[model samples]
Target: MSTATTQGGPELPQERRLVTEIPGPRSRELFARKQSAVPPGIGTTLPVFVTHAGGGVVVDADGNSLIDFGSGIAVTSVGNAAPRVVERVRRQVADFTHTCFMVTPYESYVAVCEKLNALTPGDHDKRTFLVNSGAEAVENAVKVARHATGRQAVVVFEHGYHGRTLLTMTLTAKNMPYKHGFGPFAPEVYRAPLAYPFRWPTGPDACAEEAAAQAIDMIDKQIGAENVAAVLIEPIAGEGGFVVPARGFLPRILEFCRANGIVFIADEVQTGFARTGDLFACEDEGIVPDIICTAKGIAGGLPLAGVTGRADLLDSVHVGGLGGTYGGNPLACEAALGVLETIEQDKLVERARHIGEIMLPRLEALKERYPIVGDVRGRGAMVAIELVKPGTTEPVPAGPIAARCHAEGLLVLTAGTYGNVLRFLPPLVMPDHLLEEGLSILERAISQG
Candidate 1:
């Protein structure tokens, strides 16, 4: 990778420089090949193929640099090709690639589990196991919960996105792109209402109490609390939009879970590892869940997910039942350790909060200036704005606005069940000026839209 000087920093000169039109000739050719070779089911937000990425910029194959605000859907929190992650991964690659933890356990794997046990929320004696993706972590967490509690039902919230796997897709609420014709999904999964402040039938003030009461009442009456194995939720829902539940909702729901024997599982897949200004989003409310599923930001850009929770609950499962073929690959474990080191050394938690201080006010201003911006909400770097038509809450699709951003060399992502939420998860390492420029691009895009 090349390094250059910038006005603000002397490191990797991360800037938005458009050498050609957004999808210039090189990227268009690559995209054409991808369309022919890849399945139609797989979709891409930006057609530009990345050649090198670091800090806040993604350099496309055509030499155009786009300012990144999505952070690879929150995977590269420390930034792509982060120094620590790259060094560790390089060494691990030279030593060995995969031994499959199930066959031959390694020190790095144990170290990663140890870090997870100590880092995740809750001071209880915790145990951790690794997996390949967020969906696998959630599925395994559910498995352990069911085995420990001896229950068959799992409760999840509406507008919550777990993953794309069969069971996770069943747990997911959105129907179109995620679940359409994908079912019949796994059974015994029930959906509960989320305390979504903006869309709650009652106002934001009443959403917490009423939504929690209704959800608990539904579980009690419809699913039977005693029969429920787990209550899985995303502290701040990711793909469902960055919907931070009303203040008291999580605690209320957690109380109901404790009252029953159901395990409270926080799917921190998209909100963990300093993305939400805390090491984990659950810490914001001081809620310590029985099982916490984490992925995305765990290992920089490596494929690794972890399920960390109460030791007793995890130990309840049969010994051979929890092992996977490539669950804790050595390379990923090394990458995870490097990621942890980066989080600690770089003080990314504080950086995430600083990013929020920079972004939230700007987003709130957008809400004030644009009638199409219905609401702006989120914590730390994980922020979003829900789009709606003027004078009404009717959804205004986010696609046109996002397309405009892409054309202007800004990378952003859209979410929400109605496809109207523009979520921003900028890398914690992104410079302040780039953040401001990206937001300006977004403002212009919204105006044009």
Candidate 2:
């Protein structure tokens, strides 16, 4: 009985049990229905449809409890349907659902903003506004930066993922899937090199100095520092394969933003809310940005995203400049409030550190045993292992390896622009044995391959 699996917590049993093969019969039937009804553009990572999930496992259509390592792509960090979140959302739903914050204000929305202000780094007077998704929040942040600075250019980094919308798609660096055939994207957006330590030409030690100098030089010569409105980056790159930029890379970039008048934005959609040990990943390096974009883990499992920044920068936007119909909906706001309370009360930040302690050594040992394991990196609970060719840096296909894990009961997610990294974002509240079980399953997958 691990401490993470409590007697009073999510009542579902905390173990992985397969009643049938991976997609079983019921899941296959549902998949048939899904294929008929849903568009092909919308893709799913796992084939089994979920019926119930809690603690550390997802109960699929066939009564099989599969170990969850994805956490709904980092949306359910507090664990699916956390008690506090459920209670708050249920109460809010019973009272009211959608009042449209723009039309009529509510306390929950303001309370969530207040939490964002207090929780996010920096002691400066801040203003927070809500949106329905990470893409919308990022779009709003860009709008504020451009308007406040009266500048036209925005700088992004290579191996970064913003979102799926027009501007965000332009901001995103990958091609093929995210941006293929969706060209003529928003202009004046520049992509600079990221301080990717694993692949940096100069090696890890010089990665920070070399990469930073190159990025700054490119922006200064090509984009002109004065014309750039913002430098948007992720403290820990998410969809780009959990790439943690080399040390000194972020600080130098932040320094450049401060010297110039560019708004420094940290998109914490995937790394915020205790997923990275600190409430936000920026805190890990003691770096705080002018504007912060947050979403994925903010509201337990509800849809909520926010842009919080210095009052001067955010307020510079004229009245009626920012908002949406479903932005900060009451139920989501209530759920966010519950999530904040749960983080503080449960001390999940420490739990993230514990998960890392348990995972890193095992993964590093795997790297020693398998030549295909190129690098094992990340912080807190947001860890990943990059796979490559036996004797070189070249990446081999990660799809087949992931499929092997899926064929068994373990649910894992693959990332990286090259598509050769396995990212693990387990719930902080998952029982220790389950986490141990997941690692074992992953070991089996790698060994078999």
Candidate 3:
């Protein structure tokens, strides 16, 4: 790997290198060990074994360095091995790791919640609850919404992905991988069609209105609005191909929820904390959801998730109803504080916008060059290019193309319900030149295909 330098940071390598094959010898040995030790249900996106990471690069066990565009599925927005996060985590680990927030509350946990209440997109006085993962946060949100509103039904979009827990799995739309045989899911979860302009009718504006109308109509016809507790949606669908809804769609839905006394829940697990340019994607639509679910990038790379909402709504549940034993582990909380501070001090939000500016045009150029490039859409740095048949809009599973890219050392991820979308979630801290280099690799891989 050749060394390159950003403006002020330490110099790092620019090009990716393949020492052995894709997995290399060490990775194969580890894979065999993982297969025996790890659960069969858990899966890996890439076969490469990582040894260390920093900035935008992930170093593998075989000494090959690759640019990280996936960011651990949009978790490491502040970048892998961020200095601030590392320092804070090191200090926190020295002080304490866990005390069970429920048994003995700590200042760090409360401090993190304070940041969420202040940072999440809402002007009203808000409260927050820290959780272990995205699924736990979603489940707690449901519990709070149900307890506060005395309603049971939750409306989720058709292509939405909540989590793997029983209740969240029911809230999720996909079946094969997420819900496959996890049947008899939680009750009171309803699926509604989202405003997917690429597939459905209605222009951007009209699509938003039409989806809201359909949802309202369904609520009236099937489940009365009074019986519904919350309407959960992703500002930009994550696993569902980074689908950005039509203009005014979210606002219209928010209005419908307000009119019907239904809680509005924005699932920002994959789109929050500067991953999509803005600190929160809902800010783009000028819509403030009653409840906001966040994870992934909340703690840089730590496992932490939270649900922030209006103070009254969050406090509606009794004291004991909202906590877990390891809900807000001290180390994760400190890391979250560091992540938030870095986002502000380092100006990573604007950096994410810069990344978008650099990436969007390249993707557009690719779309013009290739007939299989059906659509390119995203906000800020969260972008995706969907693959389709030459003439028809039918999704084309270019998993092979992705595999080839992986073999060549560029790690990319495929999304969409049909597994045809190439989603990009590079760390916001990546240097512009490094990002361009990764994009060049992507273009070459696509061109060869």
Question: lDDT by residue for model 1 over 244-362, one digit each (tens)?
Answer: 99999999999999989889999999999999999999999999999999999999888999999999999999879897888888999998999899899999999999999999999
Clash counts for all predictions: 0, 0, 0
Error of 2 at 311 (Å): 0.4
Tell me each candidate's TM-score.
Answer: 0.97, 0.98, 0.96
lDDT of 3 by residue, 1-449 (tens): 44534332555675676778888889989999999999988988887789766677877898888778899999888877677777888898988888898898889889998999998887899999899899898888888899999999999997888899899988988897999988998888888888887876645557877887887788878899899999899999999889998887788888889999999999999999998889999999888989999999999788899999998898888778888788889988988998999899999899999999999999999999988898999988899999998766798896877877787777788888888999998888877777888888888888886
Compared with the true structure, all predictions reach lDDT values of 0.92, 0.92, 0.86
The order by descending TM-score is 2, 1, 3
User: Which residue pairs clash in candidate 3?
Assistant: none
* 186: Cα error in model 3, Å: 1.0
Error of 2 at 205 (Å): 0.6
Extract clashing residue pairs from model 1: none
Error of 2 at 131 (Å): 0.5
Instruction: Tell me how candidate 2 scores on lDDT.
Output: 0.92
TM-score of 3: 0.96
Off by over 4 Å in 2: 1-10
Give the 10-residue window scoring lowest on summed lDDT in candidate 2.
1-10
TM-score computed on alpha carbons, candidate 1: 0.97
